[model samples]
Target: MARFGSARFTTVQPGVKINNQPRPAPRTRAGGSLVAFAASAVVLLLLLIFILQNGQRTDVHFFGAQGQLPMGVALLLAAVFGVLLVTIQATMRRIIQLRLLTGRRRTPYTSTITRPDPADADPGADVPEGRKS
Candidate 1:
């Protein structure tokens, strides 16, 4: 068997060569980055407003007593969380696409299909003679 790596497959039967090019992939535009940017900006804006109103005295805790962190640190953490969320969504979408490409046979819908059955026919059929029942 000959391997064509990334190239499209072509079949040769007898003296005739047939070019069976693979169908084009579907196009998509992910808004993960845009969402991440928007979320981070909103969080930062809110944090700025909070700092202006509350005078930047935030108590950041981890495992009970990890000491208080500055408001800047807390705002940075919120931005990181937004980025992680976007990354997770993008990763899930890629996994789903890979699964769709590698798994299950696709059966397309058809309006009508021809059936081959002689015994399964109308009993009282109207037709010109010469033709056998």
Candidate 2:
């Protein structure tokens, strides 16, 4: 066995070499940190391009109110509102489910004693030892 920088090189046969290194462990799942960062950067760059391309001012109407704003700003506001609505709805659902679960957990306690059925009792076995059935 040859040691090199916390790695062990073992020769199973005369010529075959196997490297046992702990630095580069096998990945259990796809899309590591670098891949995630690259994907986020791409998305941000696309969004920036979209905003720059749609910089023209436009009139936006909402509930009897009107305002002049950039097209990209209007779209971004709408997207933010949509996300907020969904988050609120999800939070309300989670709260309702939690309340229902808590309510159901408050069950009344039951007695441990149970009455035996008269039909299952053996009448001959209850008689005195000297007496005949």
Candidate 3:
């Protein structure tokens, strides 16, 4: 990890270029954030292009409702609604499980572990096998 001509780390090793500072550490969080940001930007750009390209309005009808929406927007709304439905269903399932768990009677905790007998403290002592030995 030595860098050329840095006098600070000359004593660290023999006749090679010495680097005073420690080796650079990878910035995982920053790099991850940057990658995520780039991905998000790309996705946003693509979405914008898709919306612009599908600007033509189309009639939309849903359970006693009617409206006009751009194709891209309508599709996006449908996808969002689908995700919401799944999320709500999962939430309800978890709630039901929690309620069931709460309603059930739980056995009171009992310690099966008892203190070691003072007689059994010395391993070298000759003794009969005790129940919990």
Candidate 4:
């Protein structure tokens, strides 16, 4: 359907081309990496400062020697402990996966399923007709 006007043809004219210079050199990937690292460092510093300002102190004992520890140190130790715990859990999970892959464990549903005998069937009944029972 014609909406604006009747269909018409005109002489084609090539538009002028602007500067086609290649784009300037992009910032190095290392610069972006450094920015991300700096941002993470800032966040870590903020977290540390917040914890030091708001947290309390405690004592830790190891090999019978007890010493008072700052809240920040304790928090750091706790974080390290949590990382170790996660590492251990991941290791155990990997070990289990490897064991299963190596055939050390059987899947739960490997065996065939068996149904109970029919209600009208008998275990030791004799043949009833010419057809084999």
Candidate 5:
């Protein structure tokens, strides 16, 4: 066999589309995550700007605790505490639900899976050692 001086390479064909129609690109988890991250970053930037703009200091009093904090910071803290309370409540509810589920699983009446007693199992029914039916 002799080699040709000019080499021709075959082009890779693109994938065939369904019904020969053009379809939009599919959404990807990374793409969605990137968008969410960008949105969160923008929100954080806006919050930062808001906090900076409201630079006035205010007195904060809570259950015998007194402190001075920026007005924006105080409001942000209040919102954070409120969110924490809801999170705690939801967490407690989930914990209680899990506990109840576990308790129910342990209860004899609630359990559906049953096993035969080992003592009730017969070694032989048709014949026995040194004996025949």
Candidate 6:
């Protein structure tokens, strides 16, 4: 019977020089932003579906004013107001922190020691005979 495939073998000589060039590094993946955008799009689509499903009209009263509006619109307005309140709170907190940081940095630091002048010394103080004027 004849062999269907022949085996190939490589022989290395003792004096033969081998090529040892280093391979280029693989590139990093840049799909993080794309993934984030897709996730946001999915969330927005779900929010749109929710709004469409709750389109029934309802009466809404705010700070003494009353008006008839769709449930979805009212809910959307409430969400917007809540987001604004949170954003304002965060901004104020950051402002206060920045003010505190800057206040701490503005104060001058001193480690100096002042010496009394010889003219301000006591008139009747005892002095060494060698240093007497």
The number of the candidate with the highest lDDT is 5
Winning model by TM-score: 5
- Per TM-score, what order, best first? 5, 6, 2, 3, 4, 1
Q: Give candidates' CA RMSD values in order.
A: 18.3, 10.3, 11.8, 17.5, 7.0, 15.3
Over the stretch 1-133, how does candidate 5's per-residue lDDT look in tens digits? 4467757666876656778875556899999999999999999999899899888999999999999999889988998999999999999999999999999888466658889787887757546676853
* Lowest lDDT 10-residue stretch of candidate 2: 13-22
Tens-digit lDDT track for model 3 on 1-133?
6668866554444333338665564579889999999999999899889888998999999998999999999988998899999999999999999988977867667768789899769774556657335
The ten-residue window of minimal lDDT in model 5 covers: 124-133
- For candidate 4, give the lDDT of residue 63: 77
Which candidate, 1 or 4, would have the higher lDDT against the true structure?
Answer: 4
Q: Encode model 2's per-residue lDDT on 94-115: one tens digit a residue.
A: 9999999999998877868888
Worst 10 residues of 6 by lDDT: 21-30
Error of 3 at 94 (Å): 3.5
**Tens digit per residue, CA lDDT, model 4, 16-124:** 5458654454699998999999999998898788678846668888779888887777777878899999999999999999987878565566778888678767754
- Compared with the true structure, what per-residue lDDT tens digits does model 6 show for residues 26-108? 44455677778899999999989888999999999999999999898899999999999999999999999999999998968
Considering only N, C-alpha and C atoms within 3 Å, which residue pairs clash in candidate 1?
A: none
Candidate 3 C-alpha RMSD relative to the actual structure: 11.8
TM accuracy, model 1: 0.32
Q: How many residue pairs clash in each candidate?
A: 0, 0, 0, 0, 0, 0
- For candidate 5, the TM-score is 0.65
